[model samples]
Target: MGHQQNALHVKDLNVAVKTPKGMLPLVQNLHLELKPGKILGLAGESGSGKTVTCMALLQLLNPKTMSVKGSIQLHGRELTDLNQKKMRSVLGRDIGFIMQNPMNAFTPVYTIGNQFVETIRSHTVLTKKQAVDLAITSMEKMNLPEPSKLMKKYPFQLSGGMLQRVMIAISMCLRPSVVIADEPTTALDVTNQLQVLRELDRLRTECGTSILLISHDLGVISELADDVAVMRNGRIIETADVFQLFDHPKQEYTKQLLQARPALLLNDQLKRRVI
Candidate 1:
C-alpha cells in the first residue's frame, strides 16, 4: 500500500530480552503494515512473540532489560528514536493500546471515572465535564449500561467483560489513528467475546481507526481481520487477505493452526463460498 494509505508500517523489527548468558530474541525481523480503517490479525501460539512485537511497536518494553531495533513508523513518522516524553505524547493520543487484561490498563486505587477523565485530559484540552461527557458517550457507544453508574466503580468491581468493554471505550475515545489490541478477547467468555469484537468492529467502521489485532485464537482473528499474518518462532510465516489465508494458507504452520481450529475452518469454508 502507499504511504498515505498506511496507518502504521514496520520494517525489520527485532526485540530481545537480556539474559544472564546473552541476548534472547523474542521477535525477529518482523514486518507488518496496517492500512487506514483496516484490521490486521496477527496470530501465533502462546509464546510466538506476538505480544512482544506489539510492545516493541509501541515502545513499551523496558530499555534496561529489553532491546528493540528497527523501524516503527506511525503514519510515516519514525517512532524508534523518540524520547520518552515525546513517545508518551504519541502513545495514547496518536496510537491507542487495548491491553489483554483491562486491569493492566487501569489503576486499582482510582475509580473508573477518574482514570477516564485523566486519560482524556492528558491528550486533549477538554475540561473535566467535557471529558466525562466523552467518556459516557464512548461507554454508550459500546452499549455499556448506565455509563455514569459504571464510572463510580473500581476496576475490581466490574466483571471481566465489562472491564474489557470499558477499556475499549477508553482506548477508542481518543480517536487515535491506530489501535494495537493485544489478545483483547482472550479472557472473556464466548458471549462477552462477541460483544468486545463487535465494539472493535464498530470502532473501525465509525472512526476509521486502523487496528493491529493480536491473538492466539484463529477464530477471533477470522472474525475481525481484513488481513491476517501467521507467526511462529519469532517470525511471520505467512500473510494474506483474510479469506485467502483461511482457505488456502501458504505455510505448514499456518495450515496446522487452521486445522486445529475445526469450527473456525468450517465457518471460513462457508464464508468462502459466499464470497
Candidate 2:
C-alpha cells in the first residue's frame, strides 16, 4: 500500500539507552508498515525490543536516558519531531495504546468509568455524560458485560480478563486510526486470549483501525495478524505474510522460534507418536 493508505509506518527506526559506560542499542534499523484495518504481528523472545518499538512510536520513553532516531509516520504525518504538547494530541486521539498489564492501565483508586471518562474528555470536547456513553458503547462492542455496571466497578474488583477487555474498550473509545497493543492477552487464560483476540479483530472490521500487535506468542500472531515481522536481538530479522512465515519461514531464527512454541512442540510430539 502507498503512504496515503498506510495507517502507521516506521522507517530506519533505532532506539538506544544511555548507560554509564556507553549507549546500548536496544533496537536497530527497524521498519514496519501497517495498512488500514490490517494487523501487523511483531513477535520475538523476551528482551528482543518488541515493547521498545511500540513505546518509541508514541515517544513514551524517557528522553533523558533513551534516544530514538528515524521516522515514525502516522497517516503520513511524521511523529519523530513533534513536541510533547503536539504529541499528546496524537497519542490517545490518533493512536491508542493498549498496554500489556491491564492493572497498570488503570488506577487502583479510580472506577473504570472515571478513567474512561477522563480519557475521552481529554481527547474530545464531550461532556462527562457523553464520554460515559461513549465508554459504555465501546465496552458493549468489546463484548464486555453489563456496560453500566462495569462503569461502577474499580479495576481491583474485576478479573484480569475483564480488565483487559475494558482496556481494549478504553483504547478504542475514540475510534483511533491505529492501535498499538503490547501483549494484550499476556495475562489471560486460553479462553480469554481468544476473547481478546476476537475483540481486536472486531475492532479492525468495525472501525477500520490498523493494529501493531506485539507479542511473544506465535500462535497468537498466526491467529490475528495479516503480516508478521520477526525480531531478534533488537533487529527485524524476517518479515513476511503470516501464512508464508509460518509455512516456510526464511530465517533459522524464525523457524526455531516457531518450533519453540509449547503448542507446536506438543503437536510435533503427537505426530511422532502417531507415526
Candidate 3:
C-alpha cells in the first residue's frame, strides 16, 4: 500500500549458478523492499550478489544457467512464477531497469531516439510522434544538454555520462512505478554524479517512483537512500533506515564500510598535503 507496507518484498531468496566446478551459490536470505517514492540503497562489495539479487527480483535471471529460488512480490503480485508473456508486460510497464553499464544496455547501431521510440511502441499503442514527445520530455527531466542533439546521436557517439543520462531517460519515459538502478553513476565524475543524483531525487519526489538503487558507493547511499540493505558474501547482513545504517551501523561489515569512506572533513595534515 505504502512505505508502511512493502511495495516489493523478498523472502528467503537463494540463487546459484551452475558452473564448471558445481552449483556456486551466490545469494542467500537476500531480502529487500522498495516502498513507493522511496530510495532503497542496495550496497555490497564486488561479487557480493548485489547485482544478482536485483536480477532475481524480477525473474530476469538467465534460466539456462542460473537457478533462483525465492518469493518476490511487487504490490502483492508474485513475480517469480509469472509466465514469460506476463512478465514482459509487467517488466517495462511497471518495472524499469537502469543497468550499471549503460552502454551495454543500448545498441551501438541505433540512434537514441530510435530505441526510445521502439520501446514505447512495444508496451503501449502510442503513435510514433506521441512516443517521441514522451521521450523528449523524459530527456528534459534528466536535465540533459541539447536534448535534440542527444536524440540524434548513437550510443557510441555520446560520452559515458551523457549515455548514462540517455539510458535513464529511456527507462523513465515509460513512467514505470518501480525502477531498479544498478550503479547509475558508475561512469560519472563527481560533478556529473551529483547532477544525476539530484535529478534522481527529483524523480523519486515528483513521480512517486519506488527505486531500488544498487551501488558500492556508500557516499551515494548516504546522500539519497531512505532505507538501506548491506550485503556480504551473498547475504544481507544489515537492513535499516539510511541514517541509522550509516550513523549507528550494527554489523562489523557495515562499520568497516563507514570507516573506509574517505574523510570528508580534512584534518590539518590532510589539508596540508592537498595544498
Q: What is the model-wide C-alpha lDDT for candidate 3?
A: 0.83
Query: For model 3, how does the per-residue alpha-carbon lDDT over 1-275 read when each residue is reduced to its tens digit?
Result: 33376768788899999999999999986777777789999988878899889888878889999999988988888998799899998887899888888889898898998998898889999999999888888898888878777778888888888888888888888888888998888788766676667767777888899899999888777777899999999999999998788789999999988878655532233223322
Q: What C-alpha lDDT does candidate 1 achieve relative to the native structure? A: 0.90
Per-residue CA lDDT of model 1 for 99-167, tens digit only, reads 998878889999999999999999999999999999999999999999999999999999999999999
Q: What TM-score do all the candidates reach, one by one?
A: 0.94, 0.94, 0.92
Model 2, C-alpha of 18: deviation from truth (Å): 0.4
lDDT of 2 by residue, 91-195 (tens): 899999999999999989999999999999989999888898999999998888899999999999999999999998988989899999999988998778777
Regions of model 1 farther than 4 Å from truth: 262-275
Clashes of 3: 0
lDDT at 78, model 1: 96
Better of 2 and 3 by lDDT: 2
